[model samples]
Target: MSSRLLKICLIFIAFLFFSCSSSDDSTPSEPDRSYEDVKTDFQAIDFQTGVNDVSIRDINGVLRFFRVIIPEGDLSSNLRPLVMTLHGASGGNPDAHKNTGCFAEEGFAAINPIIISPNGGNLDWIEFANQVLVLSLFDLAINYLPVDDTKVVVNGYSNGGNGAWFYGETQPTVVTASIPMASSYNTFNTAGEARRIDVPMYVIHGENDELFPLQRTQNWVEATRSAGTEITLEVAPGLTHNEPCNYVDHVKNAAIWLENDVWD
Candidate 1:
């Protein structure tokens, strides 16, 4: 072979050898996984802390938004309790529920449970479809986060309070306890329909509720009790239906009940 031709061939061989060696050393590219894929596939999303506004797609392919508050620390060793909050009619501000309503406040130190306050497209969460969507998100959160499935708690206000009642009665197996505040559920009106509730429910109501009278809630509690369901009702003195911020104390006590009375 000619000297010039021989040199060109050697250069080509060196290029090929280096290219193959470089390819072997490179790390494989990871697949682009969406939040929807995280519902089934694990390890991609991790158990995280702090406040996060997560938008996830449910099993039925419905897009949903929730404000999650995780405790500030490592959470891998132990499974933490989970609280799923349902917003009121017209999608009561979930941010307010976490910040103002103080559900997320209990998510540290002693009452440290993961809090999920969901926004149901600003629609009435009491609707069957919205409730199902909230439950779907709850299931997805369980798969993605480290949660103590046995201590799942549901809490809501106003129309969302009605949603809480629905889960307490219908989904007792999944829900460990429920706290329904300022809720007026007329649908569970009849004794026969309101007959049975399998889970522990602690209710909080405004004494001077303007839109929904305190009597409405009392009657429902009495009905459920009469039907052999153990329910507790705490009427906040001088509280009104419109005052959402004033409900913090009552909710805090309810958290105590869950931690000390119910879960322990």
Candidate 2:
């Protein structure tokens, strides 16, 4: 073959290989779990009607308390999603529950998720103790409850929102999506860390937030978007940092969006 023809053939072969590889990479695959595996892993625990406080020893041997809200139903009949809520600084399980329980009220009762809220022990959720405690609780919930692993969402408020970013970035496989509210990225390498996150993220912030401020959250969201992460931001008008209770409606909307748009 002529030298020019040989060069053209090699280039064409390389292009074909690259195109095929890119096409394969673009198609997403389902999670590696069978129906039998989910059924076998789920335990028959007496999940109470409302919220229950459960305690477990952390890696450092400190007793940590987490709240679980099992909606009124039988778990064996259906597979339900799980939502893990991380509380802000100085906040505990009750606070987390208060912030996220609206999921049950806002048209999610039929598909009620097992909500687990972890206490932040008055320290930032980024602290080692809190991080260990939260991750441990996740394992415990998955083993004990009939959780739909693919729909796990990690959500947080304020300082806990920071934790959401960390966990959602580091544990994308386990946490299917992240919802961070009234929070800003305080990590040393925000963009670098954000780049590692592959799950969908929904960020909600109060427009008039004094503590974290709306502009800061907007900057973080933009940076994360630049890193090629799928994220959505919802800014509540005239709301402040201390008024997270006002965010229940917004949270409901986010949950619906996740159900119809992201997860579906």
Candidate 3:
């Protein structure tokens, strides 16, 4: 072959060899896994069905407390949904757990969600420190339990309901849904806060609640809905401020709604 043709032929062979080598070295990328894809290998606790108290210092250096209720099941087999319950003002962690009936024998057999109730230091949940504390406790729960990160629901009564709105509005990505009962946002800027909420919400309140009247909850719901938020409000007739006694049914229904309606 002529010298020039020989040079061109050699260059073409080198290019083909480099292209084949590059194709061989390239790897097919793995699909991205979401939070739901990640699972704890074993049960964090021994699957005892009761309330467990947890205490830890929050980001603000304040001593914070929370309670967890594990259902009677083999956590090793299924990753259960998590429900973070907030208590009303002056309500204890255990009291909130009992009031909600989340740990009741029948209740556990029904919904089977892992429950976490965190104390708000007797302050409004809109308080920055309390918000930080609640989020911190959530992180701790996920790390310590066999919690399904994708199926987290935040619900509360009275003051806790208020906190539920706060977390549901601000941390939509973290909390999947919100259920607030007998609560109104008396502390936060409801109109401004509503614009930030992106998750679905189920709100329940007593029509005759002396502390937080039903109209207030209605107004908040209206404003939130106007802000393009998905919310449903249920007003119980003749119910008063301390309506938890008459509200357990609503709570159970909400749990069903969370499972079948929202998450489904």
Q: What is the Cα-based lDDT of residue 39 in candidate 2?
A: 29
TM-scores, one per candidate: 0.76, 0.75, 0.72
**lDDT tens digits by residue: candidate 1, 49-120:** 777665544334444556777776677887888888876665344354344234335422367888888776
- Residue 69, candidate 2: how far off, in angstroms? 0.6
Error of 1 at 108 (Å): 8.5
Better of 1 and 2 by lDDT: 1
Residue 149, model 2: Cα distance from true site in angstroms: 0.3
Best by lDDT: 1
**Alpha carbon lDDT of each predicted model:** 0.67, 0.66, 0.64
| Per-residue lDDT over 128-188 for candidate 2, one digit per residue giving the tens place of the 0 to 100 score | 6665556655655665577777788888888877888888887764688988889988423
Give the CA lDDT, 0 to 100, for residue 135 in model 1.
61
Ranking by lDDT: 1, 2, 3
The global Cα lDDT (0 to 1) of model 1 is 0.67
Q: lDDT tens digits, residues 1-264, model 3?
A: 334223333333222111001112234333342222222311233335676654433222344555678877688768787788877887434244344453222332356878877667657887766665566446545655767777888888778888888888877657889888888773226345545368889888888999987887788788778878888887777889875757766666777777788878
RMSD list, candidates in order? 17.0, 15.1, 17.5
